[model samples]
Target: MILALYNRQLVEKRSDEAIFNELKERSNYIENDIQSKLLEKNKISLTNIFELTGKDLGISFTIYDNTLQIFNSMDQYYKAGIFAERINPQVYYNLNYLSFREYTIKENIEEYVFNSFYKKISVDNKNYILAVNDAFNKVRLTFSTSDLDVLLFGIYLLAALIIILISTFLADKISSPIRRLTKATMSVAQGDLNVSLDNQEKGELKDLLDGFNLMTNELKRNQSELAELEREAAWKEMAKQVAHEIKNPLTPMKLSIQQLIAAFRDKNKRFDEIFEKVSPTILNQIESLNSIASEFSRFAKMPSYKIEEVDLANVATDVINLFTDEAVDIQLEINDQLPKISADNSQVRRLLINLIRNSIQAGASKIKLLINHENNFCNLVIEDNGKGIAPEITDKIFEQNFTTKTSGMGLGLKLAKRFLDGIGGDIQLIESSKPGATFKVTFPISQKNSFI
Candidate 1:
């Protein structure tokens, strides 16, 4: 519709301008021809000058004498004598004042019916008013609401539809590769490092697909290498820790045995007493070795996640009850109607116990637990007035066997992170300006209750 309107407007303007220029040029030529003939010492009239064209001109004219008298006339096309009763006073008025060039177009009631252009021209001091009009009385068809315009409009609509289809085809062709690339990227993110795409189309985009395939290949290779290196390093660390810890008790046990042997050789009457004193030392050292093994075994071989709807508030309450008799002050703040999360029941309990125990052992006098919802996850914020973790080790605090104090296996927060990972949750140590440690544990809300 818009195109049709624009085309119509353009054609209308062109037609009007063509007609105006044609009329102006033809009238100027006729006037100059007459003036030139008069300048040539020829007794030429307007009719003889117009006939000199030797062909039928598309202009009709009448020349007026000094008193506005019709000196001669010729109608090569039409509108020949219509101006006999109508001549401009301006031409005579201007001619009287010796200003000879006066011109104007007199319009008919209809736009394209007729237009007569009259002018005052003087040649060799001979003055006259020259009235000229178009030879072709052609009426331009209306631009709006015509049968031809309707046909053109139909063609315009057809062209528009064709363009739409072509562009749509091109868009789909362009976006198909991008869509595949996006999906492949998501696969890599989800740990499928072997993802790769075929370069179906040839363009600059082929380079993009090739680059993606190369990147994934490198990632898969690098990940395999990293895994092998990590396994070797982990085994080495574990072996060293086991050997050092076992050697601790083994040394004391060997010392106690030496003391027993001395007593036996001396025939000491207190040999039985010496044996009794050293026996507990040997048993205690054995027990320490067993404890060390058990902790490492648990850390290395965590159980598979048993996902279930677990009320976190209830789990936290139960874990809090276990440490209620301790010196540390425990404060629990929970919503009255707390949402349940999808996680292993036992893991939730253990996670809470581990964090609370950490706060107590950190010399915290007061511990705060705030349970709330964040988007599609449950946020369990644990704040403690303990000595905040040293900034240097904060980044490594989540690693297996990483710790700051002299204690048992450093697996509390590591276990928490593992459990959260299994349950599509997360744990982070919040950085605070205050003098206490803050940990935020996130558990995904149960799928049935969560919107996303």
Candidate 2:
């Protein structure tokens, strides 16, 4: 558009210097001819010469000698016609000097502008102003831009096409990396530490893509190190707990057996009575030792999940039924139509039992289980009226081997969380307004459950 405007501006505003040059060249060519004719004392008429060169006033005419008897016309009364069409008389004013002027002529009551050049020439030693005139209509007609519209349209079309092609190419290159980054981020958020991106970009984006790959690698490495540290800590803790529990049962069993051996050696009359008493204590201690071993074994190697469509309401009811004879009143409320979730029935039961057992253990007299369906999820809210968890130790509830209880390894909630994660489910402790801990568990309504 700018180029077109510049071209139009340059063409329309042609300078007077350019017009004067054309007029000067035309007049100079005729100046020598006019002088030669005058030296030969021949009568000069421009009509025959102009007729050969052009057809219109082509406005090329010479007013020589200032007699102003200017033209030779084939028509008989040409002088009268010259008077009818007006020409500026200023052509004769600066008769002895070479000069340039613009003048208007009236032909058929319409005004036409003409450019004139006046040259002083020596013809027979008399000063003659040879005047040359150029018509404005002639210049406008010659340099008019007729096909500028088509030219500008083509330029704009080409510009738009180039812009679209370049933009599409750039968008394709940029979007591929963005999509990969988005998917990789989601994987990391879901605890998948194996996500990484292929760096296939250039320039600043290449740096960005490569940086994302590096970040994921660092995250994966950090996660592995963290898991290793946690395993070491867990082993140390488990060893201490096992040693402590085994020592408890072993000390009592050893004392009871020593008493039985001493009684048998002495042949005491009440030795049978001592043996009976010692045998019961020894059996009970053995049972306690077995229970501790079983608990630790369950924690060390959790049962594999068997994914199946399970009715959560039924499972909750069954778990609640087992506690029917207890002092606590376990109330169940269905807020909406419950949806079956894809999960292991046994794990779901265990998870619910652990939460309810914790509530009962905490002295909850009234326990409430409200199950509902919320977009794409089935949520079970277990709220109780017991002594709530202490504020200081609340964060450690779901951590393995962490517990405020005096007995049992605190594997219940941790294993529950691990199971839920396996089936694309989740459990959270809601900050309660009442006096007991509230656990809200969410089960995804639709899941392609896959886990190790």
Largest TM-score belongs to which candidate?
2
Q: How do the residues 174-239 of candidate 2 rate in per-residue lDDT, one tens digit apiece?
A: 887777677556545543343446676788878887887788778766766786899899999999
For candidate 1, the TM-score is 0.42
Q: Give TM-scores for every candidate, taking all chains together and pairing residue i with residue i.
A: 0.42, 0.47
Pairs that collide, model 2: none
Question: How many backbone clashes can be found in candidate 1?
Answer: 0
| lDDT for each residue of candidate 1 in 1-452, tens digit (9 for 90 to 100) | 77777877777666566655655676688777666666773777645665563234544566677655554344422245543444556546655666656454545544545555656676557766766555333334444236547778789889989999999999999987887787666545544443446677787898899999999878867866786799799889999998998999999999999999999999999999999999999999999999999998976766467788889998887667655445678999985477789888777876777787677777899999999987888999999988788888889999988987564446668878987886789999996434689999999888653211
Best by lDDT: 1
Flag regions of model 1 displaced more than 4 Å: 1-110, 114-152, 186-194, 264-269, 302-452
Model 2, residue 172: distance off in Å is 5.7
Looking at candidate 1, the ten consecutive residues that score lowest on lDDT are: 71-80
Error of 2 at 339 (Å): 5.9
